[model samples]
Target: APLGISNRDFLQQRKVIFDFPTKGVTYMHFKSIEHPEKPLVKGIVRAETIISGYIIEQIQDDPPITQLTVISQNDIKGLIPKYLVNLASGKAPKQWIGNLINGC
Candidate 1:
């Protein structure tokens, strides 16, 4: 992250690990660890939660297709509403996939 740990919005993630479990498959894992501080906030208080997830990318060679699958749990721990998280989470993967496709 360009802003390092103190990002403007949320705390920048510390690490991302990439693994190749098979010949044509790649797995990316990310998780929010136990930070020494409570979550930061701008207007509303943000709480750190157990945000863990993995994304899988599998490439098929016959017709040349890339399959992407993302699974995550991002339940915030403060007074933040569930609906807000749901909305943001729903939109994030689509944007990622779109960007990846466009880049390729």
Candidate 2:
């Protein structure tokens, strides 16, 4: 979910690889779960993320070389316009990646 967008409950797990290599995983799975606290929304939109850990590449660049693949989807059921939802869905990946990069 986007920052400061809504209150959501989710579970995320990371698998640590022993003797890490140039290519390794930092997370395993993630899924939305039943909210235990009071949510700040009228309705709930279940979401989950499927990630393919990055692989370090033998390339030199100003930023860095790493491949991170993510399969994320949102099941927004409401009176929102289809086009608007589609547009937001398309930008989700970029937003996630950008957040990750900026964090590092």
Provide the TM-score for each candidate, comma-separated. 0.55, 0.53
> Can you write out model 1's per-residue Cα lDDT over 1-96, one digit (the tens) per residue?
122222223343644445666655666655555457845556543434355445555466688776766765654444445676577678887886
lDDT of 2 by residue, 1-104 (tens): 44434434334444545324544434334444445564435545444434433333335466766555565554554355677678887886788789978999
The backbone clash count of each candidate, in order, is 0, 0
- What is the lDDT of every predicted structure here? 0.55, 0.52
The segments of candidate 1 whose C-alpha lies over 4 angstroms from its true place after superposition are 1-19, 34-51, 101-104
Best model per TM-score = 1
Against the correct fold, how does model 2 do in TM-score?
A: 0.53
lDDT for model 2, please.
0.52
lDDT of 2 at 38: 40
